[model samples]
Target: MDPVVHFELPCNDRERIARFFEQAFGWEVQMLGPEMGNYVVVTTAEPSAPPPAPPHAVPGCINGGFFTKTPDMPAQFPGIVIAVQDIRASMKKVTAAGGQVLGEPMMIPTVGDYVAFLDTEGNRSSMLQPLMPQQ
Candidate 1:
């Protein structure tokens, strides 16, 4: 089964939200520029220093981000991102399983291909096919 690798939510004031999370939970926040859609990345826990993690992040730890909410997007509620090996196949699988793929997958520079979708229950979620490891 594909694992849930990330979480996401909507934010209004990026700076205000960043301060709240940093002070409250001690989470590190990275506010992206407008070129990156002004996304706010929240890193709850960094990768462990003692043990090696390879390409994976801190074991059992998932990082998430915040997106600017827009009225056109339905169910702007919190969502999770599932890691997949093949997004096109996964999209087809989601359709076969009664989920609706929202739009075409967009690549996040140095990140991966991402797309949102609606589950069978109409809940918003996302899928990510992380970039292939470079040699």
Candidate 2:
């Protein structure tokens, strides 16, 4: 099964949101600059880096980020990101299962392709196709 590998929270004020999570949950938030859309990386556990094990090998813990709200985006609430092997295949499955896939997948520099969707129950979530390692 594709495990939930990451999460995202929308925020109108990046600094305020980062501060809230930092103080309330003791999460470490790193604010990326404007080039990266002012995204805030939230680390809830130790070893703030991605697990050294193979993708999806880590259990029980996942890291996430907060994104600045954009008017063009839909379902801007808190959402979890599930890592998948093939984005196109996953999108097809989502639609066949009565879910609505959002817009086209977007590429995150140094990350991978990502897209959001709405499940049959109306919960919004997202998927990520991680970048492959260089040879």
Candidate 3:
């Protein structure tokens, strides 16, 4: 089954948001630069090595990030990212299941193809097909 691997939320001040999480919950956050859309990477838990983590992160725990809120963006509310094996197939499934795919999948540099959709409940969520490690 696909698993929730990440989450995202809209924020106005990256530094302030990051500092809030760091001070309030002891979470570590890294703010990216303009080239990366000023996204904030938040680490809520230390990944427990691998293998035993079902991949790399501990079960029931996931990391999330923050993006700058903009006027033109759609579905900017809080969302989660689910890791899938085939993003194309998943997109089709989303449509067949009555969910609306926002747009075509976009490649996320080293992360693999990613896309966002609105589930039947009208909540925005995303999917990521992570890049496989090379031998």
The CA lDDT of each predicted structure is: 0.87, 0.86, 0.88
TM-score of 3: 0.91
Candidate 2 lDDT score relative to the true structure: 0.86
What RMSD does model 3 have? 2.3
Q: Give me candidate 2's TM-score against the actual structure.
A: 0.85
Q: Which stretches in model 1 have alpha-carbon errors above 4 Å? A: 49-56
1-135: candidate 2 lDDT, tens digit per residue: 998988888889988988888889998888899988888887776653455543334468888999988998778898999999999999999999999999999998767999999999888999999998665
Models 1 onward score TM values of 0.91, 0.85, 0.91
Q: How close is candidate 1 to the true structure, as a TM-score?
A: 0.91
lDDT of 1 by residue, 1-135 (tens): 999888998887778888988999999988899999899988888777543432347788888998888778778889999999999999999999999999999999877999999999999999999987656
Residue 112 lDDT, candidate 2, scale 0-100 = 91
* Per-structure clash totals for the candidates: 0, 0, 0
- Residue 125's lDDT within candidate 3 is 98
What's the CA RMSD for each of the models?
2.2, 2.6, 2.3
